[model samples]
Target: MKTRKAKEQIVKELKEKFEKASLVILTNFDGMTVAESNKLRRSLKEVGAEYKVVKNTLMRYAYPGTPVEQIKDAFTGPTGIVFAFDDIVAAAKALKEFFEEKDSKLKFKAAVVEGKVADVEMIKQLASLPGREELLGQLAFTLKYPVNAVAWSLDNLFQKLVTVLENVKAEKESA
Candidate 1:
Protein backbone atom coordinates (compact mmCIF):
# COMPACT_ATOMS: atom_id res chain seq x y z
CA MET A 1 0.00 0.00 0.00
CA LYS A 2 2.75 2.43 -0.73
CA THR A 3 2.09 5.63 -2.66
CA ARG A 4 3.88 6.37 -5.91
CA LYS A 5 6.27 8.79 -4.20
CA ALA A 6 7.22 6.24 -1.56
CA LYS A 7 7.79 3.56 -4.16
CA GLU A 8 10.00 5.90 -6.14
CA GLN A 9 12.04 6.61 -3.04
CA ILE A 10 12.50 2.89 -2.48
CA VAL A 11 13.57 2.36 -6.08
CA LYS A 12 16.09 5.15 -5.70
CA GLU A 13 17.51 3.53 -2.59
CA LEU A 14 17.69 0.17 -4.33
CA LYS A 15 19.57 1.80 -7.18
CA GLU A 16 22.14 3.18 -4.79
CA LYS A 17 22.49 -0.25 -3.17
CA PHE A 18 22.98 -1.92 -6.51
CA GLU A 19 25.63 0.60 -7.44
CA LYS A 20 27.66 -0.13 -4.30
CA ALA A 21 27.27 -3.88 -4.03
CA SER A 22 29.88 -6.24 -5.43
CA LEU A 23 27.74 -9.24 -4.57
CA VAL A 24 23.99 -9.27 -5.08
CA ILE A 25 22.00 -12.26 -3.91
CA LEU A 26 18.30 -12.90 -4.33
CA THR A 27 16.45 -15.26 -2.02
CA ASN A 28 12.90 -16.47 -1.50
CA PHE A 29 11.67 -15.84 2.01
CA ASP A 30 8.39 -17.60 1.45
CA GLY A 31 7.68 -18.84 4.97
CA MET A 32 9.85 -16.64 7.15
CA THR A 33 8.35 -14.56 9.92
CA VAL A 34 9.22 -10.94 10.69
CA ALA A 35 11.33 -11.90 13.68
CA GLU A 36 13.23 -14.48 11.72
CA SER A 37 13.91 -11.99 8.92
CA ASN A 38 15.12 -9.39 11.42
CA LYS A 39 17.49 -11.92 12.96
CA LEU A 40 18.84 -12.67 9.52
CA ARG A 41 19.27 -8.95 8.91
CA ARG A 42 21.28 -8.60 12.10
CA SER A 43 23.50 -11.50 11.09
CA LEU A 44 24.12 -9.95 7.67
CA LYS A 45 24.75 -6.55 9.22
CA GLU A 46 27.54 -7.98 11.35
CA VAL A 47 29.38 -8.81 8.17
CA GLY A 48 28.59 -5.46 6.45
CA ALA A 49 25.79 -6.70 4.22
CA GLU A 50 22.33 -5.20 3.85
CA TYR A 51 19.24 -7.37 3.55
CA LYS A 52 15.83 -6.35 2.30
CA VAL A 53 12.66 -8.14 1.30
CA VAL A 54 11.71 -6.12 -1.74
CA LYS A 55 8.80 -5.84 -4.08
CA ASN A 56 9.79 -7.38 -7.37
CA THR A 57 8.55 -4.43 -9.38
CA LEU A 58 10.68 -1.96 -7.48
CA MET A 59 13.66 -4.26 -7.73
CA ARG A 60 13.12 -4.63 -11.44
CA TYR A 61 13.08 -0.89 -11.83
CA ALA A 62 16.31 -0.62 -9.90
CA TYR A 63 17.96 -3.47 -11.72
CA PRO A 64 18.10 -2.09 -15.23
CA GLY A 65 21.45 -0.38 -16.05
CA THR A 66 22.97 -1.85 -12.88
CA PRO A 67 25.44 -4.70 -12.72
CA VAL A 68 22.83 -6.86 -10.99
CA GLU A 69 20.43 -6.32 -13.88
CA GLN A 70 21.58 -9.64 -15.28
CA ILE A 71 19.54 -11.44 -12.64
CA LYS A 72 16.40 -9.33 -12.97
CA ASP A 73 14.48 -12.32 -14.19
CA ALA A 74 14.92 -13.90 -10.76
CA PHE A 75 12.67 -11.36 -9.02
CA THR A 76 9.73 -13.66 -8.59
CA GLY A 77 8.02 -14.90 -5.38
CA PRO A 78 8.87 -13.42 -1.98
CA THR A 79 12.16 -11.97 -3.10
CA GLY A 80 14.73 -11.05 -0.48
CA ILE A 81 17.86 -9.31 -1.66
CA VAL A 82 21.23 -9.16 0.06
CA PHE A 83 23.71 -6.48 -0.96
CA ALA A 84 27.32 -7.14 -0.04
CA PHE A 85 29.54 -4.16 -0.68
CA ASP A 86 32.74 -5.84 0.51
CA ASP A 87 33.82 -9.27 1.71
CA ILE A 88 31.30 -11.27 -0.25
CA VAL A 89 32.54 -14.49 1.31
CA ALA A 90 31.88 -13.29 4.83
CA ALA A 91 28.38 -12.27 3.90
CA ALA A 92 27.78 -15.60 2.22
CA LYS A 93 29.11 -17.44 5.25
CA ALA A 94 26.84 -15.43 7.56
CA LEU A 95 23.85 -16.23 5.39
CA LYS A 96 24.72 -19.90 5.04
CA GLU A 97 25.31 -20.23 8.77
CA PHE A 98 21.96 -18.64 9.52
CA PHE A 99 20.30 -20.95 7.07
CA GLU A 100 21.97 -24.00 8.66
CA GLU A 101 21.38 -22.89 12.24
CA LYS A 102 17.67 -22.17 11.91
CA ASP A 103 17.00 -24.66 9.19
CA SER A 104 15.37 -21.53 7.91
CA LYS A 105 12.95 -21.19 5.05
CA LEU A 106 15.37 -19.05 3.10
CA LYS A 107 15.99 -20.36 -0.39
CA PHE A 108 18.62 -19.10 -2.78
CA LYS A 109 17.03 -17.75 -5.94
CA ALA A 110 20.02 -16.34 -7.82
CA ALA A 111 23.18 -14.31 -7.52
CA VAL A 112 25.11 -11.68 -9.48
CA VAL A 113 28.67 -11.35 -8.30
CA GLU A 114 31.07 -8.78 -9.70
CA GLY A 115 28.65 -7.90 -12.49
CA LYS A 116 28.36 -11.48 -13.60
CA VAL A 117 25.33 -13.69 -13.17
CA ALA A 118 26.38 -16.64 -11.06
CA ASP A 119 24.89 -19.96 -10.05
CA VAL A 120 23.41 -20.64 -6.64
CA GLU A 121 26.25 -23.10 -6.12
CA MET A 122 28.57 -20.12 -6.38
CA ILE A 123 27.11 -18.84 -3.15
CA LYS A 124 27.84 -22.13 -1.48
CA GLN A 125 31.36 -22.14 -2.85
CA LEU A 126 31.91 -18.55 -1.78
CA ALA A 127 30.68 -19.39 1.70
CA SER A 128 33.29 -22.12 1.93
CA LEU A 129 36.10 -19.69 1.02
CA PRO A 130 37.95 -17.74 3.67
CA GLY A 131 37.10 -14.13 4.54
CA ARG A 132 38.76 -11.10 2.92
CA GLU A 133 41.32 -10.57 5.68
CA GLU A 134 42.30 -14.22 5.69
CA LEU A 135 42.62 -14.32 1.92
CA LEU A 136 44.74 -11.15 1.94
CA GLY A 137 46.94 -12.61 4.67
CA GLN A 138 47.38 -15.79 2.67
CA LEU A 139 48.18 -13.81 -0.48
CA ALA A 140 50.72 -11.72 1.39
CA PHE A 141 52.41 -14.85 2.65
CA THR A 142 52.46 -16.31 -0.84
CA LEU A 143 53.94 -13.16 -2.34
CA LYS A 144 56.61 -12.65 0.30
CA TYR A 145 57.62 -16.20 1.12
CA PRO A 146 60.05 -16.55 -1.77
CA VAL A 147 61.66 -13.19 -1.03
CA ASN A 148 62.23 -14.17 2.59
CA ALA A 149 63.65 -17.54 1.55
CA VAL A 150 66.07 -15.85 -0.90
CA ALA A 151 67.24 -13.42 1.77
CA TRP A 152 67.86 -16.31 4.17
CA SER A 153 69.73 -18.26 1.49
CA LEU A 154 72.01 -15.31 0.78
CA ASP A 155 72.70 -14.79 4.49
CA ASN A 156 73.54 -18.47 4.91
CA LEU A 157 75.93 -18.37 1.91
CA PHE A 158 77.68 -15.35 3.36
CA GLN A 159 78.10 -17.09 6.71
CA LYS A 160 79.70 -20.10 5.01
CA LEU A 161 82.14 -17.84 3.07
CA VAL A 162 83.07 -15.98 6.26
CA THR A 163 83.71 -19.26 8.06
CA VAL A 164 85.93 -20.49 5.17
CA LEU A 165 87.91 -17.23 5.22
CA GLU A 166 88.39 -17.53 8.95
CA ASN A 167 89.61 -21.11 8.56
CA VAL A 168 92.12 -20.01 5.87
CA LYS A 169 93.42 -17.22 8.17
CA ALA A 170 93.84 -19.69 11.02
CA GLU A 171 95.76 -22.11 8.74
CA LYS A 172 98.05 -19.36 7.42
CA GLU A 173 98.79 -18.07 10.95
CA SER A 174 99.71 -21.57 12.12
CA ALA A 175 101.94 -22.23 9.08
Candidate 2:
Protein backbone atom coordinates (compact mmCIF):
# COMPACT_ATOMS: atom_id res chain seq x y z
CA MET A 1 0.00 0.00 0.00
CA LYS A 2 1.18 3.51 -0.72
CA THR A 3 1.70 6.06 2.04
CA ARG A 4 -0.56 9.09 2.29
CA LYS A 5 2.06 11.39 0.76
CA ALA A 6 2.77 8.97 -2.10
CA LYS A 7 -0.93 8.61 -2.80
CA GLU A 8 -1.29 12.37 -2.92
CA GLN A 9 1.61 12.62 -5.33
CA ILE A 10 0.03 9.93 -7.50
CA VAL A 11 -3.30 11.72 -7.50
CA LYS A 12 -1.63 14.98 -8.46
CA GLU A 13 0.23 13.34 -11.36
CA LEU A 14 -2.85 11.47 -12.48
CA LYS A 15 -4.86 14.65 -12.49
CA GLU A 16 -2.26 16.39 -14.62
CA LYS A 17 -2.17 13.45 -17.05
CA PHE A 18 -5.96 13.25 -17.13
CA GLU A 19 -5.93 16.84 -18.23
CA LYS A 20 -3.43 16.12 -20.98
CA ALA A 21 -4.57 12.72 -22.28
CA SER A 22 -6.51 12.50 -25.50
CA LEU A 23 -8.43 9.51 -24.13
CA VAL A 24 -8.64 7.68 -20.79
CA ILE A 25 -10.03 4.14 -20.79
CA LEU A 26 -11.27 2.63 -17.55
CA THR A 27 -11.27 -1.16 -17.35
CA ASN A 28 -12.04 -3.86 -14.80
CA PHE A 29 -9.23 -6.34 -14.39
CA ASP A 30 -10.87 -8.32 -11.65
CA GLY A 31 -9.22 -11.69 -12.26
CA MET A 32 -6.25 -10.78 -14.42
CA THR A 33 -2.93 -12.36 -13.54
CA VAL A 34 0.30 -10.37 -13.32
CA ALA A 35 1.56 -11.85 -16.57
CA GLU A 36 -1.64 -10.98 -18.35
CA SER A 37 -1.53 -7.44 -17.03
CA ASN A 38 2.06 -7.04 -18.19
CA LYS A 39 1.15 -8.31 -21.63
CA LEU A 40 -1.67 -5.82 -21.82
CA ARG A 41 0.70 -3.07 -20.79
CA ARG A 42 3.13 -4.04 -23.57
CA SER A 43 0.36 -4.07 -26.16
CA LEU A 44 -0.86 -0.66 -25.07
CA LYS A 45 2.66 0.73 -25.04
CA GLU A 46 3.14 -0.28 -28.66
CA VAL A 47 0.21 1.97 -29.55
CA GLY A 48 1.48 4.97 -27.55
CA ALA A 49 -0.68 4.34 -24.49
CA GLU A 50 0.19 3.93 -20.84
CA TYR A 51 -1.58 1.39 -18.67
CA LYS A 52 -1.75 1.83 -14.91
CA VAL A 53 -3.57 0.03 -12.13
CA VAL A 54 -4.52 2.90 -9.92
CA LYS A 55 -6.35 2.81 -6.62
CA ASN A 56 -9.95 3.77 -7.01
CA THR A 57 -9.62 6.26 -4.17
CA LEU A 58 -6.61 7.87 -5.78
CA MET A 59 -8.49 7.98 -9.06
CA ARG A 60 -11.48 9.52 -7.35
CA TYR A 61 -9.21 12.20 -5.97
CA ALA A 62 -7.87 12.80 -9.47
CA TYR A 63 -11.24 12.73 -11.22
CA PRO A 64 -13.39 15.53 -9.88
CA GLY A 65 -12.23 18.47 -11.99
CA THR A 66 -11.03 16.76 -15.13
CA PRO A 67 -12.57 15.03 -18.15
CA VAL A 68 -12.17 11.77 -16.22
CA GLU A 69 -14.98 13.03 -14.04
CA GLN A 70 -17.30 11.90 -16.79
CA ILE A 71 -16.43 8.28 -16.07
CA LYS A 72 -15.74 8.48 -12.38
CA ASP A 73 -18.27 5.79 -11.58
CA ALA A 74 -16.10 3.28 -13.44
CA PHE A 75 -13.30 3.62 -10.89
CA THR A 76 -14.43 0.63 -8.91
CA GLY A 77 -13.38 -3.05 -8.65
CA PRO A 78 -9.83 -3.78 -9.79
CA THR A 79 -9.77 -0.79 -12.06
CA GLY A 80 -7.02 -0.12 -14.57
CA ILE A 81 -6.60 2.98 -16.67
CA VAL A 82 -5.21 3.14 -20.20
CA PHE A 83 -4.08 6.62 -21.16
CA ALA A 84 -3.79 7.36 -24.88
CA PHE A 85 -1.79 10.50 -25.46
CA ASP A 86 -1.44 9.91 -29.18
CA ASP A 87 -3.76 7.81 -31.35
CA ILE A 88 -7.00 6.90 -29.63
CA VAL A 89 -8.10 4.39 -32.24
CA ALA A 90 -4.85 2.45 -32.06
CA ALA A 91 -5.05 2.47 -28.30
CA ALA A 92 -8.63 1.26 -28.39
CA LYS A 93 -7.76 -1.49 -30.87
CA ALA A 94 -4.90 -2.67 -28.67
CA LEU A 95 -7.16 -2.77 -25.61
CA LYS A 96 -9.94 -4.55 -27.42
CA GLU A 97 -7.60 -7.07 -28.93
CA PHE A 98 -6.00 -7.84 -25.60
CA PHE A 99 -9.34 -8.11 -23.90
CA GLU A 100 -10.65 -10.55 -26.49
CA GLU A 101 -7.46 -12.55 -26.53
CA LYS A 102 -7.41 -12.97 -22.78
CA ASP A 103 -11.00 -14.16 -22.51
CA SER A 104 -10.62 -13.63 -18.83
CA LYS A 105 -12.48 -11.39 -16.35
CA LEU A 106 -11.23 -8.27 -18.12
CA LYS A 107 -13.94 -5.83 -19.03
CA PHE A 108 -14.13 -2.26 -20.24
CA LYS A 109 -15.98 0.11 -17.93
CA ALA A 110 -15.99 3.48 -19.67
CA ALA A 111 -13.82 6.05 -21.36
CA VAL A 112 -13.48 9.74 -22.01
CA VAL A 113 -12.26 10.23 -25.60
CA GLU A 114 -11.48 13.65 -26.92
CA GLY A 115 -13.65 15.09 -24.11
CA LYS A 116 -16.58 12.86 -25.08
CA VAL A 117 -17.84 10.28 -22.61
CA ALA A 118 -17.97 6.80 -24.16
CA ASP A 119 -19.42 3.53 -22.97
CA VAL A 120 -18.05 0.09 -23.74
CA GLU A 121 -19.99 -0.05 -26.99
CA MET A 122 -18.60 3.26 -28.14
CA ILE A 123 -15.12 2.11 -27.25
CA LYS A 124 -15.61 -0.99 -29.37
CA GLN A 125 -16.73 1.19 -32.23
CA LEU A 126 -13.66 3.31 -31.81
CA ALA A 127 -11.51 0.19 -31.87
CA SER A 128 -12.91 -0.62 -35.27
CA LEU A 129 -11.75 2.68 -36.76
CA PRO A 130 -8.61 2.73 -38.90
CA GLY A 131 -5.46 4.00 -37.24
CA ARG A 132 -4.30 7.57 -37.80
CA GLU A 133 -1.70 6.50 -40.35
CA GLU A 134 -4.07 4.20 -42.20
CA LEU A 135 -6.75 6.87 -42.37
CA LEU A 136 -4.23 9.43 -43.60
CA GLY A 137 -3.03 7.02 -46.27
CA GLN A 138 -6.59 6.40 -47.40
CA LEU A 139 -7.25 10.12 -47.58
CA ALA A 140 -4.09 10.66 -49.60
CA PHE A 141 -5.09 7.95 -52.06
CA THR A 142 -8.57 9.41 -52.42
CA LEU A 143 -7.16 12.85 -53.10
CA LYS A 144 -4.56 11.58 -55.56
CA TYR A 145 -7.02 9.48 -57.58
CA PRO A 146 -9.02 12.48 -58.73
CA VAL A 147 -5.92 14.53 -59.54
CA ASN A 148 -4.49 11.70 -61.64
CA ALA A 149 -7.76 11.29 -63.53
CA VAL A 150 -7.86 15.01 -64.32
CA ALA A 151 -4.25 14.96 -65.51
CA TRP A 152 -4.91 11.99 -67.77
CA SER A 153 -8.02 13.60 -69.24
CA LEU A 154 -6.14 16.83 -69.91
CA ASP A 155 -3.32 14.95 -71.59
CA ASN A 156 -5.76 13.15 -73.88
CA LEU A 157 -7.51 16.41 -74.74
CA PHE A 158 -4.21 18.06 -75.64
CA GLN A 159 -3.21 15.13 -77.85
CA LYS A 160 -6.53 15.22 -79.70
CA LEU A 161 -6.20 19.01 -80.28
CA VAL A 162 -2.68 18.52 -81.62
CA THR A 163 -3.81 15.77 -84.02
CA VAL A 164 -6.66 17.96 -85.29
CA LEU A 165 -4.28 20.88 -85.85
CA GLU A 166 -1.82 18.60 -87.67
CA ASN A 167 -4.61 17.32 -89.97
CA VAL A 168 -5.72 20.88 -90.78
CA LYS A 169 -2.11 21.90 -91.53
CA ALA A 170 -1.73 18.93 -93.89
CA GLU A 171 -4.93 19.90 -95.76
CA LYS A 172 -3.78 23.54 -96.09
CA GLU A 173 -0.34 22.47 -97.28
CA SER A 174 -1.84 20.18 -99.90
CA ALA A 175 -4.08 23.01 -101.26
- Candidate 2, residue 157: Cα displacement in angstroms equals 2.1
Clashing pairs in 2: none
Q: Compared with the true structure, what per-residue lDDT tens digits does model 2 show for residues 63-155?
A: 888998988777778898999998999999998888778366678888899998988888889999899999999999999999999999999
Local accuracy of candidate 1 as per-residue lDDT tens digits, 72-123: 7888889999999988999999988876774689888888888888887788
For model 2, give the 10-residue run with minimal summed lDDT.
Answer: 98-107
The TM-score, computed over Cα atoms with residue i paired to residue i, of candidate 1 is 0.85
Error (Å) of candidate 1 at residue 39 is 2.4
Superposition error at 86 for model 1 (Å): 1.8
**Candidate 2 to native Cα RMSD, angstroms:** 2.1
Task: Report the Cα lDDT for residue 117, model 2.
Answer: 94
Q: What number of clashing residue pairs does each candidate have, in the order they appear? A: 0, 0
